[model samples]
Target: MKLGIDRGSLVAWDPDGEEWVVVGEPWNHDLPAFLADGEEAVRKAERTFTNPERVSGRAPSGLPFTPASLRAFALWESHMINGAKGMVAAFGSPGVRRLVRGFEAVTGRVPPPLRPRANYYREPQFYMGNHRSVLPDEAEVAWPSFAQVLDFELELGVVIAREARDCTPAEGLAAIGGFVVMNDWTARDLQWDDTRRGTFGGVVKAKTFAGAMSAVVVTADEVLPRWRELTGRVLVNGEVWAQSSTASPLHDLGAAVAYAARGESVGPGEVLSSGTLPGCCGLEMRRFPRPGDEVRLELELGAGKPVTVTNTLGARPRRATQARHTEVARRK
Candidate 1:
């Protein structure tokens, strides 16, 4: 849990191992995973992400994998529900090592995870539908060819604490795993085009680039007041472009998840984001991410003051020369 790689590092221990090992769940588990060493249990798992082919084959007609699905998976992982492969209930949660354990302690079973880590999830464990902001694939030092109007979100995301089959707002908050910061970057002009047409896919196009919803992510171990007294700020090019607090959320994490689960299932690793807090680029009237711009999102985690993540938007490398060099390197 030391701050070697990211926040409180998470690891999985086995029967024969002498110690714990670093690991990430199925999706965005990069921060700590980079440092996990030894222990094949987590290490081997570290590379089992779903591939493009698998992702394509698994897309169901109704589109499962949303807050409700995540909650359901959490129960099974915690041993709260029936544990059976192929059953949605048996899914696992992914994140840094500590997050999994913290969640298991509350839920009783280890939720399923994609492990070690893969690209920002091409298919979320749960469906976001149309109710939230866009969480991207990664952030950039410069906006690439496909990227435009880059922006960051200051958010608090959580996993379900207990089984929330059909819960209300109050009941939902009580079942939280804890909160972590999230930044949902956006492609403004692209998003605007999609929004006007009422298209789901285009709205998601905002999520296609380096989508690491974080400049940084912290667990309660690193945050303050556990889950309250939270405030936030966004720095753009060394200036305070936006500022907010936990109270700025349209709804707390639990509320968002609960709403996501009303007719659905909420499970572990089913990311329930606060969408975009006030002041982020997506909500701005005229300002948004520009090339070479540095963006930062800062917030309070448990016990820690405030951690900030700074990102720079840069242009994509030219394909003619750079792409040829990369191709040559691959051949060699």
Candidate 2:
């Protein structure tokens, strides 16, 4: 029989149902009952997260994870040095709670307060930073500038479940919290301007920025075929302009993880967002989010509630990069 969601009475209300239910974590705890022996070890706190079920009613119809979940895994892993399965053993038993208590007593922060709900945080944006470059999609937040090629990229984000340093690709998949739709806004004008001038890795300023990411998390909660087709749209003033999908993403989770691991250690809760699709930005269409204009970004996760984002474009938007290459070249 389906185990009535009993995460040690450590459960949250289904935002949709308003009924107390077990908050699904990244993992499907179908192991043995012994794993939950230390069920009492779990505590309640403010947090966010959900599976990919599109049943909408009261709560926001998206999967938002709490930072607390990551902390819990960290503490458990420390004790279970052997691996996480051992952690399940520790929790199922009664003494597990005492052990967690002792650990908490030493380090005073409460165990699992809940992960912070990240707001529009990413490495890219409508207006790229530093140069104040103009990204392809409509800019919700004004930046420096956008006079050149307006562009956007289609990318993917790896929602993480736990954090681990020096992890491998296999570990990355095992530790991922979940998968969420991500868009790294960009500033094409700034890129074009900077390209003719000098170095430009600072593109991050124009690319990932807070609130740039759409928080529609898709965990393994719902039944999904191998690849799900979804529509991505960036609109300005009620016009359906930019269009793309998760299928258009150039990089996948596994590749990004392997590449990331080559350089630095990975952590839990970190998102590896896909950059941007090929033709979904202004650079290709030659449009940008001007001030006073309303920008609506919506992702149609077919048969699922589309993830929508609407922000008013700021007038006198910020400039990303104002490089007078011709004047400088002429002067020299």
Candidate 3:
């Protein structure tokens, strides 16, 4: 079954009536209660004649559920390679950029992306994302005051339905509750700098500012069988900017969650992302959205209605005083 959270209430879509209907008085207003109640919620929603009250025309403003934690994995090598070139063009020094361009011109073949250690192929490469910062669908995307280049990563996120630990790929896959479209907002310059200068190559301010997920969610039973076959598009200002697909990945969703479960427990409501799809982000496409631009992400999850999330970029914040480290005078 598909569901959305509207003002902390669970709302299900009515395909026949072409409207949204309150699923039920969910125990807690989100996935936990819905998951806990299982088919009972669907059964209640099905009793339309008995409980017939259409929801307001206003769209849902919240994610189907609040994720307990967010974990994103780099699963597409195509995106990595193309994104490497974009990083160089956008952040590399002029001389370095020219040299790479010259080399490509001379060789007539693009070099491999300057990313990923050999171990990338050995296991799933992932990082912990800030769940607390996730904005609901249609929320204005606040511009990061410290960043000049704002970007977006088109991805598919999986919701965990139950606790898992030391599970195999199959078991990990079984723990999935549903799927949602995700926008992993990024600060290109900050991310580059943090990964290069911070301790252990951190991704702090670069990634944690804010992220977003579609309010709509399709249940595991409906999306799992064809999740990989899903197709998507990225639109800026209502114009299609890029197309993406989930036909290929270095590792499957099962492996990603399984890797996370190793030596630790992954609980219900936690989210796992299928990293940026190839050519789906501004970084890879070499185009950034301006302030007030509307960025939309659409994914066909094959459950009758397609999942989409849209947000407008907010204006950049005013400049502020620069921060500097304190210095101590040298002693003779």
Best by lDDT: 3
What is the full ranking by lDDT, best candidate first? 3, 1, 2
lDDT of each: 0.41, 0.39, 0.79
Candidate 2 overall Cα lDDT vs. reference? 0.39
Q: List model 3 lDDT by residue over 51-76, tens digit each.
A: 54545333456777778999988899
**Global Cα RMSD, each model:** 20.0, 21.0, 6.4
Off by over 4 Å in 2: 1-57, 61-140, 145-155, 164-168, 202-204, 208-211, 220-228, 248-251, 301-303, 317-332
Comparing 1 and 3 on TM-score, the stronger one: 3
* Residue ranges of candidate 1 with Cα displaced over 4 Å: 1-144, 161-163, 208-210, 214-229, 248-252, 282-285, 316-332
Q: TM-scores of all models?
A: 0.51, 0.52, 0.88
TM-score of 1: 0.51
**lDDT value, candidate 1, whole model:** 0.41
